[model samples]
Target chain A: MGNAFKEESTELAKKTAPADLMIVAKGLTKKYDDFTAVDGIDFQVKRGESFGLLGPNGAGKSTTMKMIGATSLRTGGELTILGKDPNKQGPEIRAHLGVVPQTDNHDNDLKAWENLYIYGRYFGLGRKFLKKKVEELLDFAQLQDKRDVKVDQLSGGMKRRLTIARGLVNEPEILMLDEPTTGLDPQARHILWDRLFRLKEEGVTLVITTHYMDEAEQLCDRLIVMDKGKIMAEGAPADLIKKYSSKEVLEVRFGSSKNAEAAEKLKHLGDRIETLPDRILFYAEDGEKVLKQIHKLGFEPATSLVRRSSLEDVFLRLTGRTLVE
Target chain B: MSLINASIDSAIAIAERRSGKFGAEFYAGRTNAILERAFLAFKTSSWMIVLSGFVEPVFYLLSFGFGLGALIGGVTDGAGNSVSYAAYIAPALLATSAMNGAIYDSTWNVFFKMHFGKLYQTMLATSLGTLDVALGEIGWALLRGLAYAMGFMVIMAPLGLIPSWWGILAIPGAVLVAFGFASIGMGITSYLKNFQQMNWVNFFMLPMFLFSGTFYPLSIYPDWLRMIIEALPLWQAIQLERDLTLGTVGWSTLAHVAYFAVMIVGGLYFTTKRLSALFLR
Candidate 1:
């Protein structure tokens, strides 16, 4: 029976590229009691691809990531990681996956190197292998100087970096990062992004969940934007922007009281207009032309600027709400 | 196949059946890794925490066994042999030492690791299963029990408290005692919601320690109360260890071992179930 099953799986793998598809989910769902955290959702991730789940808090991005990471069981779905069911083969699947959770959970009593070393041990890695792996990862995280220092003494950014390094100790085939840069300063975020970019260059499959659109655009090869436990859109960053947003955006502010009124008068000036409490945004192929038309309409804004479209606009367009709020 | 290979295969088959009965995601059979992590963490932890478990019973031995035993004089052991109050209470203190070590690690330590440390979350994210976690943690607690047992035996043997060659068996007896308490304590800890709820473990423990014939004989109590005290795990542990050290081994000693064996199995079952429910879901 085992032999027959193995043959059948081999035949199935032959139909695909065998290793090309790293994760596949069809009608994935997660419900906690009466509340559904993730409605039925479907997506596929290819090998070596940097995939993103972009959504605001409680949008089921983390839920979906957990299912893919094999730490959570889906309520209803056909979800597979590396051609194995997560619910049945969670430990086997997790053996090849690195997970960097939202918060840093280091063994604070242990040294930074010991943290990496012990995490490697959890994967059943040999002491000899982890010895070199720990040193290499410490260097990768740029924490060689803090190797012997206790994790509790490390700075916030350093702690985060050590956590990331600890996750990579297994040299996982897929690295799942849940909001990897949530509480970091800009410099720390940039450093982390650079490290992640280097890993991507090394052909490690990256799965990231972030509300930061800039991080999504910079890291993700393709992504799914989620809202209210459902996927709003899925595409490459540029493709998604092009499909759902205009080429450029014109920002005009006429004071908080006048912003809504100004948006009504300037509605015909651009392809679309979204009025916020403090400012009005005009989406048009040519932002400069929209600004000029707004001036011709005899309503001069206190402040005006023209810039290119971004994933933030696409998210706002799909969800009807800003990412941070 | 060779006998060894055949037995090994059957063992694996049994394990597979157990995993299937529970859930396949729950066992990777790599509990040693979890033990390694504990030791690595322990290297830097304050030794005073461990010393406290060993010291509590010794202090109890010095105060109640030496100071109070002076007034109480001799007491009748389980085997109907009249023994000194010091020798009589020493074995019970050893059993309490084992219980203290096991309970400390499985309850308070496990609680901290579960809530604040997020250690289990970190471990679960890896390939390790809930069974690996349950067994590994309980095993560590058992080791603490073993350490305290050995330390107390060293004190007991030299003070001429241990009266028989069978007293050496108490080391392994301590392991069994520790394993039972560790498993049940870990299982019960999973149901606790907060630090305030954790105090309930200690609340039950203090009375059980005092009344389980640790410092005196259970015959002092009425028949119903004596039976109630006998049913408690601490009494079982005290009975087993005292029998081993005092040369009072009997059929009831086997009953005490059986009691803890049941606790070990039940505790493991509940602990694994709770771990998967809390984390995997």
Candidate 2:
């Protein structure tokens, strides 16, 4: 714990002094009636960092993001965007921060391109500049094919992309996305992630919230795992896995529920044992060695597999719960 | 001077100076955007606009002018001036339609944009302040009210309800009435949480439309009730439009116009403050 504090403060100091610290939140908090949605927390994101908030449902990630976006007022603490207080300078702060909300609330009355055009105009952009910016953003979000269509007529993915494009109309310095790929298919999710990566490479700061551990692993330079309005753990994906879990995980499934109970009796052979409804997960440095020992115990499980431990394992270890729960 | 008084005086000076520039440039920009959107909505939904704004006024004209006017012929106005029932009621319907259209757009449409559509949220995320949004929305309401008034005027031209060429100026007068109501409605909308509360606007607007000299002149009312009705904003607007359209202009006409002017300025001040607190805070 002492070492962790030292490292965290050092990181915080480095973040505070960076020339491009676009977003900063200090001891931020939010409460709705009796329930505290976001507990006191502090963090910073540099200009080009792809930061993430990884947690399951009801984890306060959305509340934290909304506060930074200047849409939700903070109950306590200080928050700054581009070195301006959001309380007094909300319009100015928001002018530099692009936000894609959790849900697609595109104007049904406007066409796909008009959504971008009108939003640009609201930012006080001239008509000629907004027209050109709308075209460029449509191409960037890959919504050029659906530019003229009414928002209500477009598919879900198309609408989501157009909303993302609309946020960029002001040419914001920081971009925040809440659950960007929550309901997308595998192909669509990969495409969206690819676009986000391209944005990251262009030196745009990104702050994203998601429950998908693999997504955090793929996209985040650093992330915080939140639970019940508090930060449980924070680190880079690789470092978190190394600190909380073993290098490999072994999965053993018995032929019947009765057999699975028998296999659990031999859990002392692994570093950590987790019993699921049908399978038993064994965390160990050498999954193959642990599997051989289990085989020698005459368990003869129905199925067996071995794979490297992932951020899912780290999340489960830190929160004492699975991500899917 | 004390610091507090000094700050207050400086604030007032800034407001006075900025009001002139912001009022014209900002409202012009906002009014332009709102007019564009209203036109686009009308272009796509022309039938709805025609049915609501045009047909509804005509229906009111037929029902109250010929049907109800027969029972209440040659009513005396507040100034004890006798006029034909149709002439008295025509301007009232004109004012009522303007108020109804403006209030409907400012409250229902603005509420939807604020809550469900999240349109204002998106707009505020840009450089547009809360004042810009309020001005834009009220400007749109005024434009819609202007269109309805113009259409009503054309219909009245052939009916001989229009008494003189000066009646042409009543269209813009009706728009000022709409702007006052629309600005007040925007302020009321910022306080509302759901669609259920909006019915209260009708509670106020409907009574004002019916008893505020819309059908018969206020002289028909008891003295106390007439005084109260005369103080209502729509009553003032209707009185002005009636005098202008019926060629009965007098010094009281300036007071009627001043009433709407006060409502416009005071309503806009409160509405912008409320909107800024609601959206920007």
Candidate 3:
């Protein structure tokens, strides 16, 4: 824990001095009638960086994204995008920002090409300019063959891609996506990720909010873990894994009811332990050593395995709940 | 006075400043784009549905003004005198048609786009403000109203309904009437939480249609009831059409114009305010 903390703080110190920043939030808070949705959280996003907000469903990630998108006003605190106050300069700032909301809100009544053209028109683009731009966007979204197709006829993945294409109509500098692959199949998720990867390569700054740990691990350069509207930790995925979780975890099942009993005895064998309905987990530097210890203690399990730690383990350690449960 | 002025100021600020750099031309184009979007998306079958709307009021005009005209004789006018049955009810049918076309587009269509289609949210994500949406949608409603008004006029001559050259103004007059109904209808829809709440629209519309002097004279109702019904925008619509088709132009025409002007401005103002509260929160 000490060495991991040292590594994370040093990494944070380096990132704090980023040369160019596209977004900055200071003590940002959002309050509703009964409770706080975002509790004075702080973060910074540098230019051309792939940043993430990782948390459970009600972690205020969407609320924070709304504030940064300049659509929802901040109840308190300050937010700046492209070096302008979002509250006072929402339109000016949003002119350079692209937002893919949690759901695809594309114009379902229009054809694919018409959706792109009309969305670009909202930015006051000329018909001649949009004629060329729409073709380019249709090609970019891989919908050139489906240009005249109505939006309701497209598959879920195609709808998402068209929506992303519409977001890029203005050639925005910062692209913010909320749960970009929430409902997609595995293959479609990969294709969308590839598209996002290409956008990052093109020097577009990306701000993403997702609950998928592998998504955070694969895409984000830096992320802040949030729970109950507050920051739990902040670092790169690997750094967060090293800081909040052990190097490995051992899983053993002693059926259902006895798993808790086994956990009572197995608690002393590892650095930390977590128990579930069907399995017991031992967090340790060496998973093999923990398994051996469990065997030596004369505990027979239904099944046992040893694996390396992942962001899931870190999430569990920090929030005490699985990411997808 | 200041409140209306302030809302107008903020609304204009959203239109001119928040919409972008191209100024008035850009604003016009964006609003037109929404109408254009609908145009591009409409299928032949949908056009059939729009054409069918024109047929309904004609049926009413035929049933009430032509078929029942002999039995009903002349209707009592505001001045307590009998007027031609066909002429008296022609203006009423015109007013109801405008009301139906405008309210249908603004309420059911707007609700569908807002809740199910998720269309406005997407547009609002861009530089489009509440004003662009308001004007664009109401503009489309007015276009429909214009078509109906013209068709109503062409048919009015055959029915022995046209009485004066001032009847030409009813073309623009239909637009004004639609603007008032459509704007207020959209304002009410923005506050709605679900489809069930839409029944209130029917509740208000049914009474306004029946009692706004669209059919019988206001003399059937008591004095207090007439006063209440007279203040409604549809009543003003009916009265304006009656005066124009009768060639009874007078100074009070300006007062009728002012009533609808207030309705148009006030309805549009509340629409923008309510939309901002709904989408920009």
RMSD (Cα, Å) for all candidates, in order, is: 5.1, 8.4, 8.4
Candidate 1, B1-281: lDDT as tens digits: 11011222222232233333345568877799899888888877888987888888889889988899899999987668899899998988888888878888899999999989989999999878899999999998887788888998999899899999999999999999999999888888888889999999889999999889988887778899998888899999998999999989889989989999999999999999999888898
**Candidate 1 local lDDT, A256-294, one digit each (tens):** 999988787768888998988888999999999988888
Isolated chain B TM-score per model:
0.91, 0.84, 0.87
C-alpha local distance difference test of each model: 0.86, 0.77, 0.81
Question: Model 1: runs farther than 4 Å from truth?
Answer: A1-17, B1-24
Model 2 error, position B161 (Å): 2.6
List clashing residue pairs in candidate 2. Answer: none
Q: Candidate 1 has which clashing residue pairs, if any?
A: none
For model 2, residues B196-232, the per-residue Cα lDDT tens digits are 7988888898788888878765666889888888788
Ranking by DockQ: 1, 3, 2
Query: What TM-score does candidate 3 reach?
Result: 0.90
Query: Could you give the fnat of all candidates in order?
Result: 0.51, 0.27, 0.39
TM-score of model 2, chain A? Answer: 0.91
- Give me the runs in candidate 2 sitting further than 4 Å from their true place: A1-18, A253-264, A276-279, A300-302, B1-42, B67-72, B164-166, B190-200, B247-255, B269-281
lDDT of 3 by residue, B1-281 (tens): 01011222232233335332333211333588677777766652376778877888888888888789889888766555567788898887888889889999999999998889877777767766667788888888888889998898899977668677888887788778888999899998988878889888888898888779887788778899989988888888999888787777787777888888998999988997787677777
- Model 1 B-chain TM: 0.91
Model 3 clash tally?
Answer: 0
